[model samples]
Target chain A: MTTKDISRPVCILGLGLIGGSLLRDLHAAGHTVFGYNRSRSGARSAVTEGFDVSAELIPTLERAAEEDALIVLAVPMTAVEELLDDINTHAPTCGFTDVVSVKTAVYDAVKARGMQDRYVGSHPMAGTTESGWGASMTGLFKRAVWVITFDHLMDAEKVSAHWTGIWKDVCQMAAAVGSEVVPARVGPHDAAAARVSHLPHLLAETAAIVGDNGGALSLSLAASSFRDVTRVAGTEPGLVRAMCEGNADALLTALDEALAILQETRDHLATTPPSVEQLADNGYRSRLRYEARTGHGRSQESVSPMLTSSRPVLRMHPGQPNWDKQLIHAETLGARIEVF
Target chain B: MTTKDISRPVCILGLGLIGGSLLRDLHAAGHTVFGYNRSRSGARSAVTEGFDVSAELIPTLERAAEEDALIVLAVPMTAVEELLDDINTHAPTCGFTDVVSVKTAVYDAVKARGMQDRYVGSHPMAGTTESGWGASMTGLFKRAVWVITFDHLMDAEKVSAHWTGIWKDVCQMAAAVGSEVVPARVGPHDAAAARVSHLPHLLAETAAIVGDNGGALSLSLAASSFRDVTRVAGTEPGLVRAMCEGNADALLTALDEALAILQETRDHLATTPPSVEQLADNGYRSRLRYEARTGHGRSQESVSPMLTSSRPVLRMHPGQPNWDKQLIHAETLGARIEVF
Candidate 1:
């Protein structure tokens, strides 16, 4: 590919955990990266940590304007609208993406800025309890889902190619670090995350509240099990609150469903009193089924778009296993298998 | 202590995880340990793993009866009643203790045998998810709580002396291995454990149910947050089911309270949303308070019962710092530190 055809110098606005980590990963992968942060200290820290950081939004946007493609807005949802306004004024020529968890608001904001063709809503599902430049690691997005929103206004081929290239690089890194990177449509992705991610934080917070009221000594005795259940509760409260506020309806629905399930299980135990063996058996069978269907057992390279897509220009390397055969086998069998 | 005063060839009935680990720890502490398991293979494995294992329970009990003063029932709660009955008939003179999680039923059984004077109901708050003799480790009780239940029928001095000696040694070993051992009464201990331990398992089970219902692909996107929250859900479902069934009332109560609090938070978010900073501050404050109260922040040696209690003969080694200084200071400031 010509230099003009390649994606390079990917601009990332905001040098927080997600942004900083992405900048680090892309930079290490031989792409030039420029990071913008509202805080000068965050920018300084990102620079020290090997990112090309800029404090002023306009200057950073100017640098990004020179590049033909791929500017990622990695700031919080609350900041996205303001950031988009700035991006419209300064970096109007560049194709853009964002890592915002909540999409509808940011999507509307981007559309309002008349940048719908250039901007694709994205959310890379990866992070730790920690935040900021200090906690940023190069391998953060190694095996994480990088959801890209597709709409009617976008150039399908260019957008797909841009996302596919980034996805391929990220998938390789994820495999290297013993993780998985999957793709999904924006709505399903948000709903699923709200259920598994946002709702758990609420549950953890509830447990913490119980512990606080019951007595701290009782909370202290919380072993790995309690710690695991409520770990997300221990996250920065402000971020968690923001997440819940941003995705309130979906999160509330998930929480209600979860509470209902728990209540039903509790009621069942109270009345029917099923055998422990039966409950355990059900759990094992369910987990087994989940593992079977998810392609969790398959290697990352086997599912990459580069390996599975019908496009003829990207030829499979010599000695590379025929992933299509394994994919077909998996699809036929409706489960995972050894692909040798 | 004199050789006559020291218990020799202590009989540990049921060579499962607890029994096997105790055998290893007690043996390492220069105390003779004899083990018996219903499974011959388990006994053989224990012997192969360098434990003093015996295949026949009666012979092991008879041999221990001739030399030892103490017998520890390390079987499951279901097995404890039968073992206690057998011990009452076969080896009536031995001072007994148990390592069962629940205490009320076990206490009643011991009392029914008219052996309450000779029995100290104890539960070591430590273990792994793994079971069997092969899963045993030496430092299992290190820095782990060893709750001893006391009643009016028992001699306070003898019970205190016996437990003090055993727990001090175990506590010291726990500290050496970077573990903490706290002591508590049965009622409060079980209540607290239900909240911290049992409730989490139930919560995990509920999370797993959600995972199972959602498409498997959605479940695979289950990041570290989901995995952390649901890790204990993978525990032997039968065992967890039994635990929930056995401790149903307490667990249900805890679950109700937890759910109610979560519902309230959900409502708060849905109606009048709080600032993100306030939520984060609350979480941070709660965690800090929890750490401070639990002695989780204190050095292991400082928090040991050997240092906290006033029994001179039961004091920890001279080099160990006085951890009770905080307790003493709190007391001086009119804080009531209740000891049961």
Candidate 2:
């Protein structure tokens, strides 16, 4: 199938912040989009806001199957296993993707449900402290990294033409919403997420706990740096819990590595004229390296959106050898692909 | 002692970011102020910018002594010891305050130099990641917390009237520069700084080390939370070292507490369905509590520079019994004193 199926209607399985915002974005990008929310009140509110949303998942999945629409799982991590069963039963072989924080768990759930063939996983790296229907804004993903993962699959040669078409559809939606797709593999994505996302939440929680233990006086004196370090602590607890648990192995490793560094620093701090100079210097350089890698692309949002034009594009085809490896490498080098 | 003394001439040493910015704010607030920079290039640049800056330390201290101007030690922590001797010799009786990051360290050094009678200590809770003369701005201290520490003194009654007058002048500068004076005791101030400031730096630096160890692909996947958590790691290492080493005892305690939390979380993460819900929930609540404590005052910066008008004022005479204790309590309760 030489597919140009970005025009296909999309069905979203949850109408939380990510799902609700995605529905708005897909609609604005001229795609036929509808969503389902488990909360009846949330579904009703979205419907009242003039979006096509339903409280019932079965009918929504059936409609997606009928129209060959790509199903998007925008639900919580705890909801993914049960939702996969619903998808396998109702939507059958219809291709789908998710906006979940962790990738390997979703990959495992899809394999267990025998829906792996139709699954192209994604983790949209965009959000605010607020959550739910009211917090969802149309342009939330603008200039954000929409990470696309197909690395969990055994081989690119196993990805059928039909599945490739589905993956293309997902990339189209990502681009339409003004995000650059960074390709990552299943295991590595979660591992990376553990280091950069989940571990930070744990650290922030620990920081908050420590800050609070000092009572009101300590909290009162906390300045900008303390505020920044603990800012993620302000995020919804359910979200953090789901994200951390879903990627426990990688997160545990991350916690260990971070703890080792802290313990070393703590030991040195006990000596006369405390020695954290190396760590501090290395940390400063680490931040600079990250800044160099990401550049000012986030700050350089364009008024009009397009399908992967501005950034250097890496053209690739379906069934290429080590395609996942190539894509991840290309991503690290600041390259994007329109679709696989 | 009524502090019509806000008009008193001010002399500052070390034209680094904090000192340079303080000079601008003080001048703009209608105080007679001049600064000295050891780096001739820096002094020449400040002079070119129409600020009265000198390259010679002796002459500057002599002028401050002759005019009985309040001296501000805005030098790096390592340089602090050497400069104390200069202050003791050239401006023997001139009252002074410091903008050092740690209070107890400065308090100890001042006492050893026999300059305790003429010294007040402050940690201006305001900064940018950037340092140096060029990065300093006129309103950098606007709406910032000017933490005043007098608790290092053995007793409130022991504070001579002249020193009280000097403390008042410091508060006047804080208020004039649009900062809220939060009084803290010497020991408690360093302890609080450890929990909120120094400990967070260690955490952030550790985070940076962990993130970097993940290599380029992992760095590529990092997002906002990672950015926020490691933002403090971007600060100058020397500054961080001085602040941390100056308060190593408190910092070590904080580090131990944080590591315990991480280790506990890590141990649980190895179980069936990882249990981080308690930590997650507590962290979220802790953040909300801090927001409640700080309010939105930092964002609610007054267009017109203030001298203690917007917030409630707590009046107290210097040498009152437990005056430092009262000030810390008042600060926790959101009240600011005009002066000591």
Candidate 3:
């Protein structure tokens, strides 16, 4: 697709953290971007931040429909359906997308409204503990994953014509802001997100609950580790609630898996220390692979956003010489190695 | 009490990150400090880093005993007993301390060795993902919590005469390096540490296991939230294992509590999204309290290493106008007012 074919005016419906950040990126990419926010303060802040956002949703929708703009439903899960209903009534022919975390729920909403041809579900796997326009930044999505879901939602023709164009446009826009877009089906997208996103939030929430019992001692004793682990619990409560509720089945499954692992660790702790240590070893290996993939602690030049051809292989046998050193080497090489 | 009384030579056993960091701090505080490491490489690294560390353990122990040095056992749980046995044989009368996570096990060891009068259990609540002497820094323990335990092991006389001197000396020494030393009993310290430290590691490990099921899709979807929540899982596997195993009972309790909260959230999500939102709100409130106590996301000048008197107050009821804003305002004020 040519730049002209992809250069449709972008209308973002919620000027929250994700929306505002995307607006900043798209505007920086030289797109004609308009925004609308439910809250007066949010709209005002978006304007103050130099983004052209309308206070009324209908006017933005009307203008988007007139321009056949790419409409992005950047609101929470609970608000997506209601906004989509408004769009369907007011601008029925406009193709649109959403930036909600849970794909299945939004996909279901699109399917129910028979607006699948126009609607795509996208979730940018990026955010900080804080939310709202004030906390939004242009760099928020840089080098982050922007997952696009469409298998069950779009028909083949719409998928090929509209979505193909939309995908390239979105990816190019994201790449301009340093994001990589990955295509995914709704079910798998929700499932993977549950493991990496929703589950962590739930875990953070549960940890915060655990911290409650210890009184002031917990506060005094909590260091960097505690702060890191429970940081997501400081996220916007509405978002957290939407994440847990909208993706209940997947989140529940992920939670079950996590609890099983923790329970096994607890049992091993009761039996032998080495067994629990082995569990920790497994976790370390997983995190090592993740860090290797994401360039978390490494120098930017040495890290890649994608995996390398050299894969680390772990051999489990009796008397592995210098296994720790081997693990460290594999970690530096960004390979997953398992040694037993 | 006095600078003269506190200025004793210090010997740090196991020249790992914590030990090395402490050595740098104490040595900077103008104390004669020596270190010992089982590994030759570790001792060499310490020496290269300008700390006086010996590979041979016995002579260092003898020297420490002669100077009445505050010996810090900074080894992992597995090596604690063996080193304690060596110390009991060589420096039974010299007052010593440990920097292990679990206090009961080491406290029991001290009691068993009849060295309770000389051995105080201390755990500095600070560390990074990296370990060993190479990762050590002068500010590792600065502004960190250093919990000292004595009520369970030390006799009243030893507590007053020896522990008081040791406590003051250690506190002053830690404070000089910007760490705050707090007195705690074995039970409370272990329980709190289990909640804040051990539980987070288990949670991280569990999340890592969950990510394993999804393969690279999990990696693609994992974001800052995943990294933060699972950051502790990236910790040294042996250390993670030691933490979980050493304090199995306390960790088990914490895990149970977390599971209960999570299970309740799952149930709430099934009934009403608002209920789950309430749970998320509770989590946000808890995290806000923690942040207010610690300088996690605030200006350094505004944040205290210790908790402040201004507590956040949350009053949540139906028809409450802008409760979310109210919560944020309350968090800023740090008052615990709940209107639910």
Weakest lDDT window of 10 consecutive positions for candidate 3 chain A: A331-340
Error at A254, model 3, angstroms: 1.4
Provide the TM-score for each candidate, comma-separated.
Answer: 0.80, 0.92, 0.85
lDDT of each: 0.61, 0.81, 0.73
In the range B1-340, model 2's lDDT, one tens digit per residue, is 2135484688999988999999888877667889999999999999999999999999999998998988999998788998999988999989989899888888889878778878889988888777899888998887677888775355534678788778778888888788878787777778888888888888888887788778766677777888899888888898898888888888888888988888888878888978898889989998877766666333333343353323446787766777667676675654567653
Candidate No. with top DockQ: 2
Fnat: each model in turn = 0.41, 0.72, 0.70
On lDDT, the leading prediction is 2
Clashes of each: 11, 0, 19
Q: Residue A55's C-alpha lDDT in candidate 3?
A: 86
Docking class of 3: acceptable
lDDT of 2 at B60: 96
- Return the candidate ranking by TM-score, descending: 2, 3, 1
* Candidate 3 Cα lDDT to native: 0.73
lDDT of 3 by residue, B1-340 (tens): 1235355677889878888888887777777788898889979877887778899999999998888887889998778889989998887767778888899888887788667766668888899888888788888876677776645322443243565456546545565666655556777778888888888888888787787677766775678888888888878887776777788888888978887787777677666443577678888888887876665655443465554323323444312455335434433332233222
Scoring each candidate complex against the real one, what DockQ results?
A: 0.35, 0.62, 0.36
